[model samples]
Target chain A: MKQMRRRRVRRALEEQCFLWLMRLSLLGAVGVLGMIVGVICWRGAGALSWEMVSSLPEGGFYLGREGGILNALVGSLYLACGATVLALCLAVPVVFYLHTYASPGGRLRHGVRLALDILWGIPSIVYGAFGFAWMVYLGVRASLLAGILTLALVVLPILARTLDEVVEMTPVLLRESTLALGATRLEWMGVLLRQSLPGLLTAILLAFGRGIGDAASVLFTAGYTDNLPDSLLRPVASLPLAVFFLLGTPFPEVQARAYAAALILTIIVLGVSVSAHLSLARLGRYVIR
Target chain B: MGGVVEQPDKGSQRSESFRLSGRRRWSDRVAHRLLGLIAGALCLLVVGVAAALLLRSLPLLSTFSLFELWGGQVWQPMRGLFGYAPFVVGSLWVTAVAMAVAVVPAVFSGIYLAEYVSERGRALLKPLLDLLVGIPSVVYGVWGVLFVVPLVRDWIGPWAEQTVGDALPFLGRTSPSGYGLLSAGLVLGIMVFPLIVAVTEEVMRSVPREMREALLSLGATRWETTKCSVRRVGLPGILAAVVLGFSRAFGETLAVMMTVGNVAQFPSTIFDPVYPLPALIANNYGEMMSVPLYEAALMHAALLLLGVVIIFNVGARLVIERLVRRIR
Candidate 1:
């Protein structure tokens, strides 16, 4: 009993030290990351001005008077909104068709699932290549129309997969409740869609966050130019594309501007994703209205 | 025959159609067909794109002989040579060294938070990792150049030169500018550390409490029980998390493009200029216009990257599959 008591005391002493070390370590990590964001905010946020917000990405400190990111910001908004609309345009009826209409054991259903899984593995780079070929080479739509279409392709699998899950999560009784009442396919789809609208919107917000961060696809297909976009055909900078251009330069002033731009882009994405997460989370208590 | 199967139902529903109008049997059938066709067609796009990428690269399929890509050291684009040896080897070395620097501290810290830390500390520290996740890769590139690069120039470069001047040549060419594997790995490590910590912490928390309690009841130290008992149970998840983080870091582009000295040669030492595969793809994909084969080479490089990411994802899935079994 004396020996056992002595061992217990030693273990307690060691455990206390270990816990302290662990806490200190976590603090150190958090501190390092906090410093990174702090440094960006400290230096980058200073450059934001009323005029700067309206300028194009000219090559000077804050890209000179013309160094503003207004065009790219607008371009991103246009492309993102268009892509989201196109994807939903494509996904809604597809879900209704797949789960509601297709025989569960059919080969076509099996093929569709296999196709999405394969696409998920293909790198974003390859998609850029295809966009270059299909949009610019073959198609007449070579401007923002092409960019939106490419993003639509990139985000399609993710949206479809998420929606499939959401559709599945809807209690079957909700569907059967309408179906047993002799409602046609159209009525059931309308009702079920309204019920799952929040989840679908959440997927869209997530896609927006991803779309803004990606630079590669839009790089070649949405080839950059200096003028304010004359129709969708003219290439303009997006925030990430601006960040890429700024960093790839040799100038110190340009580098600082790039830092500012990157900070803006990251915060914007973080804000959207966080809010979307909360919004989607509200679905847990949703009453369908 | 398929139409006939629905015909009887349609005939029975005609009585109800008297209550409705205009929407006929043929139109409903056409609508069903159109919806199925569109959904099926939409799903085909992913496979189609992947297939298209693979097929277009078939002309140079002869060039991708794995041995040529992996075994040779040369990467001269002008000569139409595509030996991936340099870039491939560089990727492995950088990723491996970076993982060594990242994983050790990340694991211990992750365990600390998951098993040992007070709630207040955990709450404060977790957001930093989230912030790290949120920081743009381009911003990391800027900080690396402005702060990390110069710090290496002043401190690490000279200190290494003095310590190992006669003993090693690595200290000789070490970019006194800090734009080498060391800085690259440092930035990569910082970027990926959050990933491992996040994953390991999650897995540790999910481990049954009984395992930790049994060790504690036996008078094991808290760290001892958590480390040996809990970590053992969650080993596969830890492996998966590390690989996932490393895969992401390996594929990173803009940050590596800005910070990696952007040189095309195989790395000579911890300090030599280098390029990663994704950086190669991003930098040259648009600019290699004077040369046609060069564009093809970039595409081939992209294919190479896609191959690696697929392997990483597949490996992670296998580990996760094992985890699922154990949980069940």
Candidate 2:
């Protein structure tokens, strides 16, 4: 009886230790996020200015002399918007094909999903390299269009897969009723599209967030310029690349600007994420579970 | 058929409706074919990317043997000697270190969220995890440079050197600067932490409730029930999560590049600087285009990175699919 009581005490002690360890670990993880945001905000706030968001970079921007990252800001928006639209075009059809045309238990559906998963895993840098190779073969130069194309490839799988999950969650009875009403597959897809509108919007926002912040894939394809892009063929600056290039300079001012650029990019991403989350909850009321 | 039979009195209306239905069917067939074609093209794009990388890298392959490229230690672009040993080793060391530092804590945190937290707590924490995951890699790199590097240089490095330097030579500081494998690993570990936690939490949640109930009803403690029932059932899924995290950490370029002192060398210790494969490609691609075979060599590095990541991702996905099948 004494031995059993001792064993029970030891077990209780062990449980307490493990539970505390878990709490500490979680605190550490959350602490890391707080630190990242704190550092960026603390460093970036000083460099951010009204003019910085409005004007173009001067001749000596890299030397920390003068200029704002407006060029990069606009360029990033253009690139991300273009890529999101392009990816949406392809991703929507693919998701529709999976749900409407392909049999639920078919190998084709599985194969497509597997392909998308692998594509999603491929690094942004690899996509950049492949895009660069293709541009060279096609006799095209680094430009906004090139970046858009490469970034489209990067976000396609993400858009498709997220939308796929949303579509998968949709009630099957809705589809059966639509088809039973003498509607064709295309007509049924229309209903699915409406039902999954919020999810589709969320997917687009997520993909846009990814596209805007990605530096690796656009490093080679979207050659940075000081001026806003006038044509699809002209080079354009991006916020991620702007941060990357600015931070590399030996000048303290430039590094500060880099921080400011990072802050802006982070804000844009966080905004998109928050909106996506909110919209999902808000618009999801109309969606049949 | 019943509608048509009932509308037999209205013959002209029935015929008009039949024609309309025929046209609708034709359009549906056309749309189906079009969408199917697009999906098929997406698959072709994957194949196209792999083929393009292989073809672009062929020039380097023809010029140098695979053995020379992989086994040689020196990397001199001007001298025309391309050795990938240092980069390969560097990537492995950083990724290994990242996994080591992150796995246990992340798994623990995931379990805490999944099995221990209230529903309200889980809902609040899961979005925070998503936010962490959404932060760009460049921001992580900047954070590393500003925060983690200094912390390592002033504190961790000195403490490590004093306690374990003599006992474990690899733990010793080979370079005074804190930019090296450890810094990169710490930053990358943080970046990948949320991913592992999210995946692990998901996998743990998927473990059936009955298992936990059965174990708990037997008078087991909550911790004991989790360890015996939840972990046992979720082991394969947790493994898949780890592999997915590994693949993500391996291919990350910008953050790793900024923190990992881009010196192309085989690291003798954790503090020694090294260059990784993705960094090798990112840092050199545009500037070194004038050098002979430089582009091809970079392409080869990209190909290598892609191949390894794809293999790992495919394996993890298969494991996940099998687990899902078993659970269902």
Candidate 3:
């Protein structure tokens, strides 16, 4: 009886110890996130100004003598938008086919999912390398078009898989009813599209967020230029690369601008993510669960 | 006789409907073919990426034996000597260190969220974790350069050297600049933390409630039940999560490049500077065209990175699939 009581005490102590350890680990994990945002905001707010967001860089921008990062701001918007549209065009059809035409739990469907998962895992750097190789073969220059194409490839799997998950969640009874009502496969796809509209929006926003924030895939394909992007053929600057290049310079002023650029990119990503989360909840009212 | 009669009646009714909705039937068939074609094209694109990398890398392979490339240490593109040992080792060191720093804490945090937190807490915390995951890798890189590198240079490195230098010789040599494996690994650990946590929590939550209830009825403590029931059942899935995180860290470029110091050498200590494969490709692409076989060498690096990541990703996916099947 004495030994059993001691054993009980030991067990209780062990439980408490582990529970505290887990709590501390949780705190540490959240603290890192807090620190990242805190540091960026503290440094970036000081350097941010109306001129920084509104004006383009001048002759001595890299030297920290003049101008703003309007070129990168607009360039990132254009690249991300273009890539999102391209990826959507490809992703939608593939998703529709997987749900409608392919048999449920069949090898083809599984293989496609597996393929997409692998694609999603391929690093942005490899996509950039592959883009560079293709451009060389096609004798194409590093430009906005090249960047969009490569970024599209990078986000395609993400868009597809996210949309796939949402579509997969759709009730099978709905499909059966639609088919039983003498609807063709194409018509059923229309219903699926309408039902998954919120999911589609979420996927687009997520892909755009990923595309705009990516630096590596665009490093080689989208050659950075100081000027605002005027044509698809022209090289374009991006906010992430802006941070990279500016931070590498010797001038403190330049590094400060890098922080500001990073701040802008972070805000954009944060907004996209929050909206993606919020929109799902808000629009999910119409969804059949 | 009744089944045969019903089958003929159904076939005639289907034919009649098809004849009545002829245009709709045509449109459906056309759409199906078109969508299937797109899906097929997507599959082809995946294969194309791998093939293109392999073909582009062939030139370098033709010039150097696989053994020479893998084992060589000199990496002077200007001098026409290509060696991958340093970069390979550098990647290994950074990834290994990052996994070490991240896995335990992340798993603990994940378990805390899954088993200990209230529903409201989980709801609030999950989106925050998602936000962390969405933060750009470049931002993480900048954070590393500004905060982590300085912290390491000033405090962690010197403190470790003084305290543990005699006991472990590896801790004796500190990189003066603080831009080395340890800084990169720490930064990467933070970067991959949310990912591992999200996955692990998901895996743990997938464990059946009945199992927990049964254990609790037998007089097990909450922690004891979790250890025996949830952890054991979710072990393979947690492993898959870790592998996924490993693959992610291995292929990350700009962030690792920024903090890793980009020195092409086999690091003797955690503080020593090192170069990784993705960094090699990203940094040298601009100048690669000027040197013979330089572009091919970089392509080979990309191919190597892609090949390894694919293997890991496929393995993890298969494991998760098997686990799901077993659970069902």
Give Cα-based local distance difference scores for all models: 0.71, 0.91, 0.91
Note the B-chain TM-score for every model.
Answer: 0.81, 0.93, 0.94
TM-score of every model versus the real structure:
0.80, 0.96, 0.97
In angstroms, the error of model 2 at B238 is: 1.2
Better of 1 and 2 by DockQ: 2
lDDT of 2 by residue, B1-328 (tens): 5544453565664656544477788989999889888888888887899999999989999999999998889988888999999999999989988999899999999999998999999878887888888899999999999998898899989998999999999999877789999999999999889988988888888878888898889999999988985556789888888999999999999999999999988888998888999999999977767988888888999999999999999998888778877876
Q: Give the TM-score ranking, best first.
A: 3, 2, 1
Error of 3 at A132 (Å): 0.2
What is the full ranking by lDDT, best candidate first? 3, 2, 1
- lDDT measured at residue B269 in model 2 versus the true structure, 0 to 100: 90
Report the CA-based lDDT of candidate 2 relative to the real structure: 0.91
Candidate 3 C-alpha lDDT tens digits along B23-77: 8888988898898788878877878999999999899999899999989999988
TM-score of candidate 2's chain B against its reference?
0.93
Estimate, for each residue in A81-136, the C-alpha lDDT of model 1 and write its tens digit: 77778877887778767667776769777666556544554545556777765653
On DockQ, the candidate that comes out on top is 3
DockQ metric for all predictions? 0.40, 0.78, 0.80
Pairs that clash in candidate 2: none
Who is ahead in DockQ, 2 or 3? 3
